[model samples]
Target: MSYFFQIVVSGMVVGSIYALAALGLVLVYKSSRVANFAHGQIIAAGAFITFYLTTTVGIPIFFSFLASMVITFFLAMSVERIFLRRLIGEPIISVIMVTIGLASIIDGLIYLTPFGTENFSFPPFLPQDPLSLGGVSISWTQLVGMIITFIMIGGFSWFFKKSTVGISMRAVSDDQFGSMSVGISVPRVFGLAWATAGLSAAAAGCIIGNITGLNFDTLHAFGIVVFPVVILGGLDSILGAVVAGIIMGLIQQFASGYLDGNWGLNGTGDVMPYVILLIILLFKPHGLFGIHEIERV
Candidate 1:
């Protein structure tokens, strides 16, 4: 039972990270309907930037974190402005291809840096102690990361529900044409959406980097893993993203804890989310919170 509880605790931590990572993807999709393939690259960039500032420039961790967010925020906006802006009305395929290309470009740029080949961890800021209860233990880093994740999530929820800019963004998501009719700048909203997503991505990256250390490959993999999370949650639902991310996290942790060594199952945790993704697509195609659209001729 203690072991089970321990797994639960660990699952929650991982799930929180997934939720934060997936939030950005959902934000981009919700507003602009753009599936950002370069998201993982952005995450890597944020992590690397934070690392550089903290280690090279000797900035404090907290301030470096903020700087990284600001940097990525503008970087994402520039990507949208320079590359995606002109392709706005183009086919979805065109937009997707552009994102893929952007990812490759970012990858190339990172490869030119030491981060692409070397592994690095954040300078320790949290106490090097583990909090334990009833045989379940969590490191300070994980606990702090979870707290930050919840705060960011709450902040985003409040922005969406209460703030004018957030309301405008949501309005754009609901109906771009309608928003334009109401005097909203649809393009500006799109830029803001990307900017916000970038900001969230930076936060997620910093958390992950602190928890797992910095590795370009591992950091960027969050981008691919997030797809299952958002899909399970609902492509355009923020609340759905949170719920699904935690669910997937639990599923992964439990699979690793119970199924990995039993029988021939190995690496089940890594594969389970995609398995569930397939099941969801086959049965609940609209996802848990996704609205089913009916187009009538």
Candidate 2:
């Protein structure tokens, strides 16, 4: 019983991270209708920057985290301004290929640094004790990471609902021509959307770094996992992303705990989520929360 609850708790933690990761994809897709293949590299970049700032630059961990977010915020925006800005209104496949190119370029650049070949973990700043509740335990790093992720999620939710720039983004997403007729700069909105997604990616990177240690390969693979999250949650729905993230997280954790050891299954945890994704998608092609966009003949 305790073991079951413990798995549940672990799933929530992972789910929240997945939710955070999916935000980047959702934001980018909402504006440009292009998927970013380079997002995992951005995540890795932010984590390495945080680690560098904390260890070598002598900044506090919290401050380092903020600094990394701001830095990546600009880094991502530059990628858009320099490489992608001109590609606006081009074929969707062209834009997607550009993102893949950016991913490979970033991969090459990171390889030149120590973070590319070496594995590093953040120096522990929190107390090294796991908080136990009813025979279930969670560490301080996990608790803090979860709190930060939730706070960011709430902040983004509020931004989309209330802020002016956020509203502009929403308008552009709905209809770029309509937004432009109303004097909104569609290009600027697109740039801001990418920047905002970058911010979210940085935050997710820092959280994962704190929880799992900074491994280039591990952080790099996270982008691939986010596709299912976006698909499960509906690419255009923020609320759906949040719910889907938690669902997938819980599913993976529960499968790992319950089905791994007793049966002949060895990697059920890794395989089940995709299986479920295929099954659910067969039923709801637009995803659990995706809008049913209709085209009139």
Which runs in model 2 stand beyond 4 Å of their true positions? none
**Candidate 2 lDDT for residue 171:** 93
Q: State the number of backbone clashes in model 1.
A: 0
> What lDDT tens digits, residue by residue, belong to model 1 across residues 1-297?
999998999899999999999999999999998999999999999999999999999999999999999999999999999998898779999999999999999999999999999999998998998998878899999999999999999999999999999999999988889999999999998899999999999999999999999999999899999999999998999899999999999999999999998998899999999999999999999899987778999
Q: What are the lDDT scores of the predictions, listed in order? A: 0.94, 0.91
All candidates: TM-score: 0.98, 0.97
Over all chains combined, what TM-score does candidate 2 have?
0.97
- For model 1, the local distance difference test gives 0.94
Give the clashing pairs for model 1.
none
Model 1: which ten-residue window has the lowest total lDDT? Answer: 286-295
Residue-level lDDT tens digits of model 2 in 122-196: 999999999999899999999999999999999999999999988999999999999999999998888888898
